[model samples]
Target: MNIVVGITGGIAAYKAVGVIRAFVLLGHDVHVVATDAALRFVGRPTLEAISRNPVHTDLYEGVAQVRHVAIGQAADLIVVAPATASSIAKLAIGLADDLLGTTILASSAPVVVAPAMHTEMWVNAATAANVATLQSRGIRVVGPGTGQLTGSDAGVGRMVEPDEIVAAALAALRPRDLSGRRVLVTAGGTREPIDPVRYIGNRSSGRQGVAIAGAAALRGATVELIGANLEVSPPPGVRLTEVSSAAELAAAAATSAASADIIIMAAAVADYRPEITTQSKIKKETQGDRLRIDLVKNPDILAGLASTRHRGQVIVGFAAETEPDDSALLALGRSKIVRKGADYLVLNRVGWTEGFAVPDNRVLVIDLAGDIVMEASGSKLSVADRILDLLA
Candidate 1:
């Protein structure tokens, strides 16, 4: 998803950085269109670094490329954080005097604005009327919730929090295709303990799984997010269960899967565990660095779910492999699907630089019969929706 975050001048302009970061972390391409005054509060380099895209400010800088409109044309969503009184009035009347104004005018995407100004300014007749006009034009207004204002002031004109803004912005465009469905998702990498202070774990930050859970909630599904050592927070409005080891995850899944309409196993479960865990940390000096720990295979959670799933239930499994050959990757996926008994297997290649904790992912999904069913590559959230499209 391509997101354009418009930052206008205000004390709240600094808050837009959080909004930009939230979008970027969710695997969207964020392009910032900051008013010159907005740049006064937040630095251009900071915006560029967080957005991972160049900041576009000047209306004349890219006139040859018609860049003013191109940014909006490519946008899937536009969010204006700290929309000042002047900016709101300009937006209400469809002003194109600045790049942000022109971008909004050029795009057909939904517009979401979080207003921020002095309480008096926000409550003024002109500001209230401008807000009403924007809302009337199908614009989504998140909030100018009552809270702290600039120095020595507090009122209802503060910008809403970044997370709330992101949620509202995404919700404005989301379709509830999974309404009335129950979804169970397992995310993050499970950790198996070796001793009191030592443990074996994978580098799965649970990003991919978290995205699936968040996307499911956005689609109007009743979401149960069972996270295993999650490195990131799950989106709002989902039932969250935190677990650690593979056994813990298996237990939780068994208890939850019975009622779920769709079960997505995105957690990277450890295949093996220490057969005997020490009561205390193993001292390296005492062991002379020659200690060996026995291993035992963990239960196959996906297979168990597939075997016991009720009719009309769907089970999706993920396979993160390191094979470089495309043919080999697909072969591995085909074999895993058969072995796991999952309805669909999402196969992704992961290495030191790709997959795992990254925001984006590339996956090939195959069904029970080893037939390719879906191929998706993009931000994890986008990939997640494509996966959900299969069920929807």
Candidate 2:
């Protein structure tokens, strides 16, 4: 794959190094086009070293070869990370003042932009218009995530992580087989509050769920991510709703499932919660060493959605088990498929050192008769694609 990475002026330009490196490591031929202002944040030498190609900025450097236009001509994909408001405006209006601009204008390949700016600038009418215009022209836009900003300020204008940017770019290059579909994905471990300070929770990082949501969005689906205590940021280009408890998750799932063409239950929802939630922090001394608390079972969110799903709506459920033996794990997963009434059940072995918070996972996709439909193992993102393949 030939990838052209564009770095624009923004404090977040420094982060584009990771984006370039990610593509490079994936065996993609990467060419970087950085603005002069972007050089102020990340030096040309660093960008060149990581990309293993000379960084292009001057449109006059290779006039004989028509470098500006030629770079785009040979490119399979073009990505601009830390796309500043100025650069976005230039692209939106088809301005070609610089090498990056000219290259983008000359390209027929898919164009992906990762916008990073202060909240005020991002939400400004001009920027919004530019973004809207770009999207209208078939360009793909990633995040502008919500988080701590350059200084004391913070909002929904932070650049998403580099890996996520790469994921979005990859997705943009893929065929939109899932176009016009609505996908609802649940992620993270639900926390059942026992007190103001403490609660029962699992170790799920929500990476798999986030990956699934991102995959669906990349495949042209309208994605709604019902996240609970996520360790990772929600992928750019998906609707995210945050929840903390199983009850909240149930309600959120129920609501989103109403319009979903596909529902993936990837969250590690708690099976039980404290019967009585203490408003104040429980005192350790008063409770003593052997304190006992009443617990109650949580609602079966997946089963409820499965039972109510419209015909043709696909319901996928997850089974994360600790059983080391394959046969035992398969048995448990098979039972779950029947119990949940899901169209497909993904069963994975999870241990303290392996699954919960890790980036990689191995899963067996099972059907209602306890038969294995498919087996997959790889980065969560790859597994997500295979799962989506089942639907496709």
Candidate 3:
């Protein structure tokens, strides 16, 4: 993919370096086009070094090649990170006063804009009107998240993280099959507390669940992610609810499921939790060599959702097995689908190296009747997209 990254003037412009590197690392040909003010924040040398291409900031830099119009015409996608209120107004009004503006005006490829500015500026009537105008013309806006900003002031105008911008850009290029739908996903291993300092938890990193939520959001679903101790940041554009125990996860899942069109039980929720939680930390020296703790069964979130789901709602469950053989795993998965009353279940072999903390996954999607609906092997994101495909 050929991607054009437009950087405008903002303190967040410095973060655009990561945005460029992210696209390049994803195997895309990246070109950085910055405004004069953007160059003041992130220099030409740095952008050139990361993108591995000559940075363009002037409309006349490559007149022989007609670079201004040519670059945009040939782009597969255009992403403007740290898009300032100034740049937003320029693009909104079809201004071509600068190279970045001219190139954007000429581009026919999908455009994704990530806005960053002070909270007041971002919410001003003029900026809001410009944003509405741009979106009315089919331009996609990523975010201006609320957090610490340039100085002592902070609110809704912080630029989202670079990986999120990349995710949004890629999402903009895909089909919007899940648009207008609400999706609920759970990820990470639930941690059950035994004491103030001691707890039981699984090795789940939440990569697969995050991937599914991301893919669903990219496909246009309004996603609510119930994450439990995730090893990674939740994907951009999803509402995140963080939890630490099975009970908390169960409550979150049950609450969000009421309005979700699709619900995925991808979290590695503990089947059991410590029967008793001590207020004080357990000490090794005081209770030398021996330890015992009772366990209690956790509510089956997936089964409960499946049983009470609306007639047209779809519920999916995930089964991680160490059954050691394909036949056994398949049998277990088939039985689980029926037992849980879920419309679909994803079954995967997991152990120390394969599923828990890894980036890729191998899985079989089994339907309620024990039929294999889809089998996939690749990065968790790919698996996520396939799951959505099946849902569609």
Index of the highest-TM-score prediction: 1
Candidate 1 vs candidate 3: the TM-score winner is: 1
- Give candidate 2's root-mean-square deviation (CA, Å): 7.0
In model 2, what lDDT does residue 224 have?
98
Q: Give TM-scores for every candidate, taking all chains together and pairing residue i with residue i.
A: 0.92, 0.70, 0.73
Write model 2 residue lDDT over 122-196, tens digit each, in one string.
999999999999999999999889999998999999999898889889987777999999999999999999998
Candidate 3 C-alpha lDDT tens digits along 296-340: 999888898888998799999999998889998999998888889
Clashes of each: 0, 0, 0
By TM-score, the candidates rank as 1, 3, 2
lDDT of 1 by residue, 1-392 (tens): 78999999998999999999999988788999999999999999999999999999999998889999999999999999989999999998888999999999999999999999999998899999999999899999988899888898988898989999998898888899999999999999999999989899999999889888888888899999999999998888799999999999999999999999999999999999999999988998999959888999999999999999999999999999999999999999998999999999999999999998888899999999999999999889889989999988
Models, CA RMSD each = 2.2, 7.0, 5.2
lDDT of the structure predicted as candidate 2: 0.92
Q: What ranges in model 1 sit over 4 Å off?
A: 123-125
Candidate 3 residue 227 Cα shift, in angstroms, is: 1.7
Candidate 1 positional error at 112, Å: 1.2
Minimum summed lDDT over a 10-residue window in model 3 is located at 20-29
Best-fitting candidate, scored by lDDT: 1
